[model samples]
Target chain A: MNISEIRVLIGDDSILARKQMKDILEEVGVKNIEEAANGQEVVEKFRSFKPDIVFLDIVMPVKDGTVAISDICAEFPDAEIIVISSVGTQSYLKQAILNGAKDFVQKPISSSKIEEILLSRFERS
Target chain B: MYTQLFGNYLLSKNIITPDQLVDAIRKRNDVFVQPNTIAMHFKLISATDAEYVTKIATDKDSDFISTAINLGYFTREAYDEVKDNTLPEYLFLGQSLINDGILSSSKLEEYIVEYQSNNEMIDLELYSDQKDNLDQLLLNLFIIANEELPLYIGKYINLLFTNLIQFIGEDFTPLNFLPCEEYPVSLCSYQRINGVHPLTMYLDLDEKVALEFASRYVGESFTEIDEYVKASLEDFLNLHNGIYNVNLSNESSIEMKLDPPVFIEDTSITPGEKEQLYMLPIVYPFGTINFLFEIEKQETTSLF
Candidate 1:
């Protein structure tokens, strides 16, 4: 899979966060990108868009990223969900990994980290 | 921070008028003592050498110290010695106040003694160099009676000052924290920290100040409060809160999550029934910005 062909989904309650990540992904040659504002939206968008990669935030209004990860992985076991959160506690990290998240990135998100993740995932595919 | 605290003390004691304080701060910002002036004050360089270096610096578009060093007028050690004696802004403000004749030298000395005694502090010169001493002074100034809140609030404020120095300009003075029921905000961005202990942190600024602050953070001259300005302000808050949360997680094993920053315009934010709101006013060259921290004992029930 080429970088531009990868479908990316960003689930963050912050409009600025989503826009920032989208801009970074676009700069990394990601052509198809989708955004969700909450955990419920993340699961819904994952089912509809079936993105190759998902960037999820832990804190949201309707649903959180941790539970959404579990939901998405339960239906689509091959789903590649990356948990992105400002909180980097051991408990959250442990829970996110146990829920089948592929990786974790803390905020404020850096472009290099996104690119590294994207390059690694693309290589695996 | 001590400057603003001392200024407020002077205002409260009727020793200096508000106009005088403002004038002193404005003058303090404009007062830039050149290296030659400092060297002359310390008698490190002769007047003729200083004048020669000044001429060359102007002609070469260089600094006085570098030009003097290049011309062998003064050693680097002498330049460092002169630089070491440079005064901090608070002292500069005091000198400016005295120069303006708003307060006599003797009266200023008395006020300094009283301010130090009331705050149980040492000389201002040492206070700026010592972080622990400055933190102690901040605790004394802001945390009057609160016990637990002071620990978090003090850490938050210390980190805040560090961030302000890192991102924004370092030439700022923090005023004493004022307890207020509500703040009339022109532009405000805030985030809530939820988990074991919950707190709401916000930066409130006047429209013009917000534009200036965003411009400084983004390294762009923003003339208006547009989406870019708003996003920059929100990103700043998020970055600060995110760093604070990471520290808490790494050091204390505490799990606290941050809500997405919300931007509000032309409104007043009121504290909850059980919450206490503190407005920390920080004065910059452009304007003053108030950082509002609201903390409550009760656990947050809602997710948003």
Candidate 2:
């Protein structure tokens, strides 16, 4: 698959955050992208939108990114879910990893970091 | 820390005009200690020579630092050292004032001395970024706040101030906070941090400030309040609280959980029975905002 061919899913309660990430992804030449405003939508979109990779925030309204991560991974087992959040503490990081997240990125998301993560996953897939 | 404090101090003493203070604050980060100014200040070059260096640099489309270095007024290593060392923010404020003709160079020096002595914190230089200095400065800013609020609440406010400069524009001034039993909310977004130190923080904004603040936060022009603007406010509160929780967890091994930020309108935010409440008014150049916070007193003794 080409770099721009992969579909991306962004999950966060914040509209500004979603736009920021979506803009960066488009800038990186990714065309197909889906967005979820909550963790429940994230899980639902993972099953329906079937994105190649997912960027998830831990804290959401209905369901959090941690539980969403566990749900997607347990069901699919091959889901590439990345946890992006401001709470980068040990407990959250450990819980995210134990929940089967592929990686963790801190909030005020950086473009270079996103590009790096996307390229790594793209190459692996 | 000292920049805002000293600015507030000057305002309290009726030294500088409010318009001049606002202009100075907005221009501080844009104007740094230039080489010609430093040369003239240290008498390394005459005032006329500094002007000539500036002219030469402008004509050459270069900077005062490189022009001065090329003119052999100061060595490259000395210029590097000065550039590497950040002058205190209050000094930048002074520079801003002088550049805007609000105060002469000597008058600014006098105010600096007065500010340090009046505040009784002689080590004004140490407050540049030192966290401990901030805690002391916060205590000094509100001498009776500790008695009203609590220990970590001051820390939380300090972190909030830092985040304001980090995320939002630096044109706002945080006015003194007053204790309040009930705060009427206009357009408000709130998030709670619950754990060892539990607190509910509410950001209330009248429509005007909300528009300007959302514009600054999202880097887009927002003239009217909509779902997007309200969501932006919630996101900012969430961002600040998340970073605060991260800091607490990393630094103090204090773990706290945050709920999603919610947008509430036409409501009253009051303190709970065991909560200590306070409201701080922040003045941006565009408008004003009120950020209210209430922290619950712990049932058990504090571990740290």
The models' CA-based lDDT, in order, is 0.77, 0.79
Q: After superposition, how far is residue B28 of candidate 1 from its true place, in Å?
A: 7.0
Residue pairs clashing in model 2 are none
| Deviation from truth (RMSD, Å), model 1 | 7.4
Best by lDDT: 2
Measured against the true structure, the TM-scores of the candidates, in listed sequence, are 0.72, 0.77
Give the share of true interchain contacts found in each model.
0.42, 0.69
Worst-scoring 10-residue span by lDDT in model 2 chain A: A116-125
Candidate 2 residues B166-211, lDDT tens each?
7786556666677888888999999988887788899999898888
Clashing pairs in 1: none
Give the per-residue lDDT of model 1 (tens digit) for B145-191: 34435466776777787788777876666666678888888888889
Report lDDT (Cα) of residue B297, candidate 1. 47
**DockQ of the two-chain complex in candidate 2:** 0.58
RMSD in Å for all candidates: 7.4, 6.8
